[model samples]
Target: MREKIRSGGNAGRVFVLVAVCCAAAAMPLTFTGPAVALPSIGRTLGGSPLALNWVTNAFMLTFGSTLMAAGALADTYGRKRMFLGGLAAFGLFSLGLAFASDIVWFDILRALQGVGAAAAFSGAMASLAQEFEEGERLRAFSVVGASFGVGLAFGPIASGLVVEAFGWPAIFLLVVALAALALVLGAVFLRETRDPNAAGLDWKGAATFTLALAFLTYGILQMPDVGWTDPFVLAVLVAAVVFFFAFYRIERSVARPMLDLSLFRYPRFVGVQLLAAAPAYGFVVLLILLPVRFIGIEGMSEIAGGRMMIALSAPLLVLPIAAGLLTRWFAPAVICGTGLLLSAAGLAWLSQFPVGSQPELLVWPLLLVGIGISLPWGLMDGLAVSVVPKERAGMATGIFSTTRVAGEGVALAVVTALLSAFTQMNLGPAAGEHAAGAAQRLGTGNVAAAGSMVPSMARAAMLQAYNDAFSALLWLLSAITAATAVVVFLYLGKSADVIDGAAGEPGPLRTTVMDP
Candidate 1:
């Protein structure tokens, strides 16, 4: 009877792992799928560039901002409850997204969908911590990470095929189905868990942080359309600064803050945060930007674009696992820093090719980027908690995850604005008064629409202008990534010590219950 019970317990844990992994896979699928379908969404919905951007931006904004708060809520309220509720909300929102007719409704639903994603992801992660321990826990998280990789690896191709066949709505339908399966499994297998010492939700901090990011993203996304000096843009940009200050104040004053501001005092902790954000500018933005460049700007078929994206993302499926294995021989800092430098090289190499370069010309650089980013990606989660004291592991994890996701949203907005600015400058004499308008369209990957707005003779010039702008953007990204690599390397070097007052010792990974 005892043996049978032990075997059943193992079986139950396996089911729980499957449930959480399903939820993990769905999140990235939602994130990457829309990028592949952005052109289709724009065509069907007929929204402006700003509105179209909100399709991806809205989801990222809420998801990233809500993560910390969601993690806290799960800790206090019960992980299983939050997980199931979040899954249900995610499924409902995805359903609404599938049927959304107007771009406005679609954007609203996408934002709400992000909230659900945050809640579900935080809750699922917390529950996993409770379900597994020590070596088993590491294995479980590895499997979860692999599940996420599978989604990122195939999301573009899957979305492209779906969009080609059944339209953009089908992508959301797929998410809905996945959410449903996860919900059912979680309902059956998940056990409720909570932090007994958890404090009240930091409403002020959450509000201020959310507002700061929202204002900043809005101002940046709108700057290209309405000049930077436009009163409304300036006003929102100022508001962003003020709210960020307010968020800083709130977190410091709160007894149990969503983010422990003190963590920044530790160089290694700060380094980990920076490392988390590096991929946003270097790699994540490309997930969206490249799809648009291929299908919308270069006029490649959706299937072809998706296939090309595979070269950029497929390395993730194996490189992350390989990174973990390499840790036995090399320090995580050396591995991660070397990886970013490699990615910088890839970016610089890719810049030599024009926007419409053939897949053969682009594959190697794209593959290099995938291989480079994966090393750091695999190790970041482990590094986040390891750098801090065991007691603060949960907060460290939450803050690191928040930085990563939020940074992606911010990077996408900034890169989009920069691309438009570059394109406008390149189109100077040829486009004349229509330069700004054409630049906006081209920046958003609406090449067909942008061409129609300009003279037939100037269209060739416009395409060439876009290519130049893209090349300039890649070089800028490369430089920033390389600089970041240097900083991360120095701060996380052997001289760095754990925040727990340890001296001259690299932080070791411990079995702590992470809340996020």
Candidate 2:
């Protein structure tokens, strides 16, 4: 009877944790689903492409920077309190977006939404790591992974439905309702689990770190427009570097830093963290390109394009569960490494799009990519957290979160830059009169003329550019995946639990019971 009760309690906690992750995962997609709609949004709001880009970039910049600080705060205060507070904030801000009349207000509200999301995600992850230590950590992590899959898979569908039913504002409003529901549930059942030894919040460290990340991300995002050599961009980049330096100096001297730099000293921690970022960014690229390629270029309807995406996303939902099961027997790195390779291979296959490529041609590679994306993300996260001391688990989570988001930001800029360069180079002088004229007219906010300006030669040139971009990204993924393998083999050493007597005593992983 005692064993049965204990099992029931653990099961209930897992259910609550999964629900929290699902809600947290949905936050980012609120931005992602609208990325393609930016062209239309800009026209409606009398804004520019730059403004639309900021709509997405603003949320990402804030979310990435605050992740570490938010995790620390959760540790310092109380996880459950922070979690509910964050959910409420997220809901309110998302609701604000639903009422935003213009682009400026939309941008402002999105930024706030990001802060709230950072808090919620950081708090929930910290709670899960604390709650599930030994028997169920892998399973718990896989649930988090499923939340991600569900978020990405369903976000577009929700956005489409909302847009069709009540326009774009409805999309934001729906998220608001979901977040509000999460807030209520979190407050009702969640419990406090802050580490006993967790130190006070370091406000100075948080501010400096936020500035550092914000400046860096802003500069990177604007790179496609201004070019990296522009004085303003260069200045911001320098400022970003300086802030990071200052942040590190402050962290080292503080009693309790927002981030613990020492975690990187562990090879498994570093390797797994690095592995996490590459694939995280890689999938973002795939998601962005596949829709445009399959639907916009291939003459498929929006619904058809979205449905085709299932070819990639369906497998994403399943592979993580498989990875979780396999991790019970195999080394996390080995399983994760295999997944990375598979993803790279799938991407390589996708990079070979023929002229006037058919949507059916892409099904196999997309399905493979779906599987590839899931495994690395699932396994690497477990490996990273397991290596860290429980005292710094929050910090570890923050670091992993920060890097993955940062990687995505940097990847967007780099990929956009590379694609622009390729398009320009491939188009040559003739494209100036062909594609350039049309793009310039469209970019300048002329909808009607731009709609009629599509030229065959321009389309061909753009497709070539896309092919080059995809190829370059595949090469990048291959290099990153190979390096991850070497790092895991050489630096990461043995899997956890397999490592016998260490040079020093490792910290005990603190486990806590919480109300479901």
Best-performing candidate as measured by TM-score: 1
Model 1 lDDT at residue 495: 56
- Residue ranges of candidate 1 with Cα displaced over 4 Å: 1-7, 494-516
The digit string of per-residue lDDT tens for model 1 on 1-516 reads 533432358898898899998998899889989999889889888898899889999999999999999999998888888999999999999999999999999999999999999999999998888787566888999999999988998989998899999998999999999999999988777777787788869999999999999999999999998887999999999999999999999888889989899889888988999999999999999999999999888888788888888888898889998999999999999999999999999999999999667789999999998889999999999888878776677788999999999999999999989999999899887677777888999977898778877765366788899999999999999999999999989988745445656432223332234222
Residues 409-486 of candidate 2: C-alpha lDDT, one tens digit per residue: 566555545554444455466545444433322332233433455544444555555456556656766566566656
Alpha-carbon local distance difference test for all models: 0.89, 0.66
lDDT for position 181 in model 2: 68
Name the 10 consecutive residues with the lowest summed lDDT in model 2.
497-506
TM-score of each: 0.95, 0.85
User: Who wins the lDDT comparison?
Assistant: 1
